[model samples]
Target: MKILRKERGGHMLDSKLIRNNPESVKKGLKVRQGDSSLVDKFLAVDEEWRKVTIEVEELQAKRNKVSDEIAEMKKNKQDASRIITQMKEVSARIKELTDKQKESETAAQKIALEMPNLPHLSVPEGMDSRDNREVRTHGKKPSFKFQPKAHDELGRNLGILNFEQAAKISGARFVVYHGLGAQLERALINFMLDLHTKEHGYQEVMTPVLVNAKSMTGTGQLPKFEEDLFATRDDNFYLIPTAEVSVTNLHADEILEGEKLPVKYACYSPCFRREAGSYGKDVKGIIRQHQFNKVELVKFVQPDKSYDELEKLTKDAESVLQKLGLAYRVVELSTGDLGFSSAKTYDIEVWFPSENQYREISSCSNFESFQARRAGIRFRSNPKAKPEFIHTLNGSGLAVGRTFAAILENFQLEDGSVEIPKVLQPYLGGQKKLEA
Candidate 1:
């Protein structure tokens, strides 16, 4: 049995297409604003690797024939010294070819992993987020009667957040939640989990906060994106960059019945990232954090229904902001701004009154079998049918820290207090407002 397929965590891209029709793959990458030169390099290395495989097979065939000759010679009580030497020489040649094959395979694998998923046909062409097309806006942007303070300033005035203390203990991009700040964070988590499980037909999951390298790779966060993750000091495991890493890998290497076609999960986990590339961007306040809380939505479904499912997932995330009385807009990501594994994406940005512009709080994406192909997650349509890779999708139900910041800035009262959204009042035990 061919138990191991190089497809599993070797790299998410389709090796066959890359090796046979690299030009098409190059065009797709270019559409996604990715450097297509990797395809050229991968094709060259893969060709050499295949050549080595052929040479190794020929040597093995010669060795096998010689082995039979040596056995027959022994049976005939004839000389075997010359044949034995030939066998040894063939063996040495095979070893050398095998080593060369390994080197070429490594080079190809690196390029494959770096290649991003192809953009869906419907995606708009663009160069970056600047060119993203806004689909629709929900809720009206709150117009303040008086000058409004930013979330961080309001948080400090309310005595519910301490940035200096957080920096002292951890470093920049960290915040110490004080009193109501801690309670508010907790309340938001419970509220989101309840809404997803009760109303959205999703099962709640508490996934691990840390995961192995393959788990990261399954969700398209490894090899190319390793520098953006935080690793444990004593282990190879990385801090879960997002709950999607743990939740999506839940069915890795598993084959499910067709009845389980649409498996949905709502997971909560602490997300950690090194934020490696953003040197001076969003450096102030809790807008960007080294550590944050997120409620994630993950789905594994039949291939044909994936786009439809993506629409619903995006709505599910939007519901969070609606329930909190926040204004938001959904923007469809163009090819250039799409994530590594996503064939299509929609980013939901919440309105921050102080900033007078919407800020992203959720990103819903449909990976269209890219992740399942890497994770080896498949489903059989029936007993007589072969298993096929299922489509994988995930999104932030809402990033809690960003949401928390939104509430502070949007719900700020003239008296320097923050009112809790009505949906979360029950979770907060009838607490309606937070004050000093």
Candidate 2:
């Protein structure tokens, strides 16, 4: 129950549907970037599994009848030796059938968990981020009077950022933030937490940075993407890649009453990722790091209201940039580009002056019931009502390091100084700028 078993809706694909009309599963599989013929392979194995289950059921019933007869003969002082031997034979057959049924079911479940969540009907059809449709753009992209320095150079000149020391100690994709640089990252964390908790009605939480394997699986990050995780040998604990993994699993194996259909949490954690798949990408900057701070937003809501909740979630994340006067754009992810557990997603990209383009700062997604099904998160409409999977949603209100980098590149002045946004001035003790 802590992880996922006894597959139900949301986490479990409709195996019954596939058995009845494999064409249905085949059609839906393509929407998830799956092989269309996978259904055929699944059905072939499941068909044998069904047969074994039925055989086990029939043998078990026969053994029950024989046991009843033996009891009656014993009471009557009659010989029951022959009946006892027959019962043993029936028991053996039942055990064999049971094992066969289990093997088939285990394989089917493995395949099912590997499949990605189905795309929402409204999502555009295409492959990767390149095909993501632009939904909206916000604020104004700043134009520098002189060519703007990249964030790394800007921070280096100001004596606040050091990749050399970071690499000497921790290897690549790590950084050491000093003085104002460290303060800026801290300020962004507090600013985001306060905004989300006070104005956006989120309950702030500080979740653990290391979690058990089951917790990782509950949020759909295991068995499929294990390579991306950093695990400890002592107890199979993993360094959390995001607060979303810890926060979302808070209600795992829980049942909420109808009145509490919507629950929101704003969590802060220093995320860790191996960057396993990115060999040469963002190799020199904080964009892809071994560890970074982030303020995460997570929600649980009724299935019917999940999409509406997604729009609100996206805007809530955008508000962070808005307050800081950072320009950005939002793009709706296509089916092929969707995350493993998300049905629909919106990527918020902040404009970086040095790069001359926007880069993703947050990805807000509505997982429908996909994660709930996996995590055993459910709610009952009433005391007498049946429990149903609740919808899950999450987003990065903003990544702290990315925000820090954006500020440095966007606000760099010609005099080797960086201007601080007015909203963050109070957080930085009314400091005006970081000067060399």
lDDT of each: 0.89, 0.87
Clashing pairs in 2: none
What TM-score does prediction 2 earn?
A: 0.93
Q: State the lDDT of candidate 1 residue by residue for 1-436, as single tens digits.
A: 0221464245677788787788888998999989899999888888888898789888888888889989999999999998798788889988898788778877777788888899998999999999899999999777778998888988898898899999899999899999878989999999999999999999999988889998888888887888999999898889997999898899998998888779999998889989998989998779899999999999999999999999999999999999999999999999989999899999999998888899999999999978887788889988679998889999999899999999988999887788999998898889999887
lDDT of 2 at 219: 84
TM-score of each: 0.93, 0.93
lDDT of 2: 0.87
Best by lDDT: 1
Report how far residue 143 has shifted in candidate 1, in Å.
Answer: 2.2
Worst 10 residues of 2 by lDDT: 1-10
In angstroms, what RMSD does candidate 2 have relative to the true structure? Answer: 2.4
